[model samples]
Each structure stands twice: as structure tokens, then as C-alpha cells.
Target: FMTLLIGSILLPVLVLVGDIVFMFVVVSAALGAVVMTIYGGFETGIEFCHRITMAVPETYWEMIFPSSFEEKSTNWILN
Candidate 1:
């Protein structure tokens, strides 16, 4: 009974913690991108942000439904 009670409480707490951590990571990544574009003299902050946002979200999406993804210069679309 105690174990079941603990599990019920712990599961939601763990999920909340995981969500908070993911949010922190996303915010940090955005801030880092802004700083990188500012100090690194990228054409625009949004451009740097765009590149990162493009690759990262796609990678996460692919993790679940990975099919045929190619990379770099060798991509068939590039050829």
C-alpha cells in the first residue's frame, strides 16, 4: 500500500520535473543562440535561431519516426 501510494505521487512529480528541465534547456538554447549571433556577428539573431530550430526539432521528430534521413553534401536532394 505504501509503495503504491509513493509510486502514484512520484510519477507525476517526475513528469513535472522532466517538463521543467526540458523548458530550461529550450530557453537556454534560445538565449545562447541570441548571444552567439550578437557577439559572433551573424547577419541576424533570428537566422542563427532559425538554423538551430530547424535541425533540432527535426532530429527529435525523427527520433520517434525515423525513416530515411541523409546528411551533409551527400544527401540525394542535394545531388
Candidate 2:
């Protein structure tokens, strides 16, 4: 009877401790993921902005002004 009484009290305490530890681990992982995502987004945005600014003139002429390309080529040939 005494053993049963002790077991009953200890079992709940162990279960509670396990639950608390599990919650702590899960929360820590979630926080880490959120922080990484924010930093990753900022890094990607900066990289994309740099690439766009460097490449915009070339891209604009190629895609939006094919006639200009022909004019330049003909001028070069005539020269």
C-alpha cells in the first residue's frame, strides 16, 4: 500500500516534468526558425535589389527595344 501511494505521487511529477521539457524544446526551435527566416528574407531581398540595379539597362534594351538593336547594328555596318 505504501509503495502504491509513493508510485502514484511520483508518476504524475515525472509526467509533468517531461511535459515541461518538451514544451521548452519545441518553443526554442520555433523561435530559432523564425529568426532565421527573417534574416534570410532580408539577405535575399538585398541580393535581388543589387542584381536588378546592375542588370536593368541590359534587360530593358534587350526586351523592350529590338528595333534599337537593328538600328545600332546597321549603323555599325555602315561605319
- Score residue 53 of candidate 1 by CA lDDT: 60
Each model's TM-score, in the order given? 0.60, 0.45
TM-score, predicted candidate 2 vs. hidden true structure: 0.45
Question: Tens digit of lDDT per residue, candidate 1, span 12-65?
Answer: 899999999989979987897879787877776767676666555356566456
Error of 2 at 37 (Å): 0.5
Q: Which ten residues in a row have the lowest lDDT in candidate 2?
A: 70-79
Q: Write the per-residue lDDT of candidate 2 for residues 25-75, one digit (tens) a residue.
A: 667655655565577786755554454343334454654554565434432
Please state the error at residue 37 of candidate 1 in Å.
1.7
Distance (Å) between predicted and true CA of 3, model 2?
2.1
Where in model 1 is the C-alpha error above 4 Å? 44-47, 54-61, 71-79
